[model samples]
Target: MGRWDPDARGRLERAALELFAEQGFADTTVPQITERAGLTTRTFFRYFADKREVLFSGEEELRERFIEIIRTAPADLTPVQLIRHGLEAAAETIFQPLLEYLRTWRAIVGSDGALRERALRKQELTIEAVLTVLRERGTDEPAAEMIAKLSNLVLQTAVGRWVAQPVAERPLVAFVEEVFEQLRSTVAGEPVHR
Candidate 1:
């Protein structure tokens, strides 16, 4: 592969994840990632600000997708239903194909305090974006905030389970629906089915 090769960003991401997994996040460097990808240091910088950006570069796009999902959801849906709809859509469209990448990214982020904090910050920004969209759609502030937080929980839990499951055992959307069902059961004072 050369710098002009297709999927330079994808190559860099894969190379970074491999290096991070083998050498640890703190031990990985831009030159090593670029070398592993058969890309130049300049090509790596073209796609990311730093090595960390390789892991988190999709967050802004994800936030935008979430906002779009909320903005376009059916007006008749209750707050919880609207959130569920958005989360399921995101799971199918944004996360389902990235299970392996996300599992690797999650492990690398978890091993480093700063990376974990960065991931949390990105999640918070996404939640804030969803909250704003919900409020714009006329949900009350308190309800919007709660729904935003709950949606994050559902997304994280669903993605966690989806990544942990054997490939083809279940779709990410199923996990999202399951978590929502559990949330509904908990709120209704019914026994959650685990």
Candidate 2:
């Protein structure tokens, strides 16, 4: 393969996911992934540290975008509101295009214990990224951390529903908003257990 293969990273990511799904993550190998992607193992290592990293290749970009959008969000919005805005931007730019991938990714990660742990680490990274932006916006440390974590909770809940439905049912942004509202009501002492 040429050294300058375009989108080698994406190809590797797709290949890795396919292999992980077909053979199970524990059974998949770096050489197998590289072979599936039609690239050398050297090219695979250039894009990712390992097979696990392939599933999370988008997180770094998503983190940066979340931080950027949150930082530039309207100054008057509360930290939670800012987070919602950031998540809205993410839904439009990040999650929307990858809804199907999100479902598959969730299943792949959930199916493996190690992957689930790594996925939690990714979630922590996302929370830290959000807190960074919120703190830069002058939110108190506790408030920033709380808002960031809460925002992630709402996002997680909403995304679960979002990917299960047909895209035509509702946009991810709308699902996020509805989930946040439900979260607010539940936290306000509304009987949510029923």
Candidate 3:
């Protein structure tokens, strides 16, 4: 056990992201992160297993929250509607206040192969969590898998566009809803895209 600082973990994550963006992930180190965070290396380790974990933290919490949201959603929602509601819940919970972090994270994670792999693994885990929720709702087989994949795509596309596009006055959830609606329309044969 190490020192307990209420803000230590967030500070370490902020410091790590800043360092990773400035010096590149391959060149940044734990000491540098701790130093920048104004915390001891032991404090950093108390919060994160390693420097890489800094970039990948919160994933478990996010997954748990997302699954819980799905599980508690209204029982009458269609499978697609359930996924959409899950996306909306995620938007409210995970992606809303993370805009700046999303930008920095895109740069850092996109620039590093290892980080990208970790991100993909996180996606896989999220999909699995969604699948578990869908299965518990009595969804089965290819339908559940397909809905899970589609939901992931909607999430990825929304987040990607949200981060890659310019800063806008609109909320992130609005963008997610817009993208999801467009996807739904496209799938319905109305083709929002030309």
Candidate 4:
């Protein structure tokens, strides 16, 4: 590869995901990923701290996006509305375009215990960030905490359904909206529909 390869990070990520799927995450190495990507080991390290980082490289950015959504939301919106707005935005901007990649990534992460633990920790940190931002925006602590946790559940459920569908005809935002409706119905003591 040249010194200035285009999309080196993307190439590295695709290569790593392919390797992880074929050989298992534990058996894949930096050299193998670099080799598959036609990149140097130095290039791999420049993009990711380790193989695990490949799957989680966008976590901090995602968390920041959520915080920004909460911080800039209109004051009149309820906590649940704020979470729904943020999740829908995320689905449209982040998850929708990466549907196929995420399908593979989720499978690889689900197969490994360590990766699942790391994913949970990252999720907790994201929820904490959302809670802090909500409180800073004048929401009470209890409501902010509940909203933050509920946001995580909503996002996870939406992504799970979006990825698991046999035909992804609807966008991920649709799934987010569906989940929020289900949440609202359940809280209202109405029959929750699939």
Candidate 5:
């Protein structure tokens, strides 16, 4: 079994998703999540602090996982390249189930303003965490943060579309690379000063 289990996290995650879907994230309670998970309220509290936290339950774990992967990545890789490599490794541990949760996450977030804000907050924190790792590896702050934010965007877009794609043929890493290429092309059209 992977260090992170789809089954165990899924239990809590799915419980939260259902309650948020049915009763709303704001309306749901911690007790209800425990009840749905067939676990204790203390257990629920052990894993999550409140109903809103369920959406972010895995964020820290996966962020640290990816950061470790990046820190240990080979020396010669470029920042974008290393991020890509780290993402591939992290995907094995991170992406698949997150895609599953995002479907429900998207629905709930779309319906509620507070949930949307929370989701944005989580994304910002994730980008900040990634940037911190990059800085530790000696990357400059602004560039590292920009790339991290862009990488995150690719992951979210890919995961959101992966299951919904007509062919379901593109790899997630490929999607990130594709996005980078598109952005590169967009920038290429700008007039050069030098």
Candidate 6:
């Protein structure tokens, strides 16, 4: 079978989630994932470069998906608004199915020291993705990077709440917009321009 089979990848993902929740990311090994997936080591290597990657391959897809999506966003959408759409698109593409894994994934990384460091590295790559998209749109490099990073923070916060919140009435994109408004109010009330 090819390395990129969605079913195979899903199996690996499920296996990794189980293992991570049980033993934590640091203790989880590729062989463990392969064994749990009932696949050979060769298969695991085919789908992911390493064990840590099972947690993160979605971020790579998120980068590509967000760039393609934000490019076509309506011109009248404010930058944050456009980014909210991009985040929601990426989330729907990547997260809705993985909600089952979210708790396990968080448990593995939540309090572990090494997993936290690795998660930060993954976040840096995500930020770079945002900057790349902003630059490609011909936004001033600094300002684009600034706005992209801000949007990233907004998305991060929004997603954290959306996933954790018991409230089911609002969509994630709507929550992102709500947080942005909250941030705007905070900014507008600041004592002085920094």
Write one digit per residue (lDDT tens) for candidate 3, span 1-194: 25567888899999999999999999999999999988898888778898999988887987898889999999889888888888888888878888888889889999988889999999999999889888998887789999899889998888887777775567768877898888877878884444
Model 2 / residue 117 / CA error / Å: 0.5
Give me the runs in candidate 3 sitting further than 4 Å from their true place: 1-3, 189-194
RMSD of 1: 2.1
> Candidate 1, after superposition: displacement of residue 148 in Å?
0.8
Error of 2 at 70 (Å): 0.4
Q: What are the lDDT scores of the predictions, listed in order?
A: 0.88, 0.85, 0.86, 0.89, 0.73, 0.73
- Model 1 scores a TM of 0.90
lDDT-based ranking: 4, 1, 3, 2, 6, 5
Model 6 lDDT tens row, 131-152: 8877777667877777777877
| Per-prediction backbone clash count | 0, 0, 0, 0, 0, 0
RMSD (CA, Å), each prediction: 2.1, 1.7, 2.1, 1.9, 5.5, 4.0
Local lDDT at 26 for model 1: 93
Pairs with backbone N, CA or C atoms under 3 Å apart (clashes), candidate 5:
none
Q: Per-residue lDDT tens digits of candidate 5, residues 24-81?
A: 7778888787788776676666667777777877768777777788878887788778
Q: Kindly indicate the candidate among 2 and 5 with the higher lDDT.
A: 2
lDDT for each residue of candidate 2 in 23-113, tens digit (9 for 90 to 100): 8889999999999889999998888888888998888887787778888889999766777887888788878888778888888898998
Off by over 4 Å in 2: 166-168
Q: Judged by TM-score relative to the true structure, which candidate is superior, 3 or 6? A: 3
Against the hidden reference, what TM-scores do the models get? 0.90, 0.92, 0.90, 0.92, 0.75, 0.80
lDDT of 3 at 192: 47
lDDT (tens digit, per residue) of candidate 1 on 1-194: 45267799988888999999999999999999999988899888888999989889987887897789889999989988898889888888888887788888888999999999999999899889988888889999999999999999999988888888766588999999998888888889986465
Candidate No. with top lDDT: 4
Error of 2 at 167 (Å): 6.8
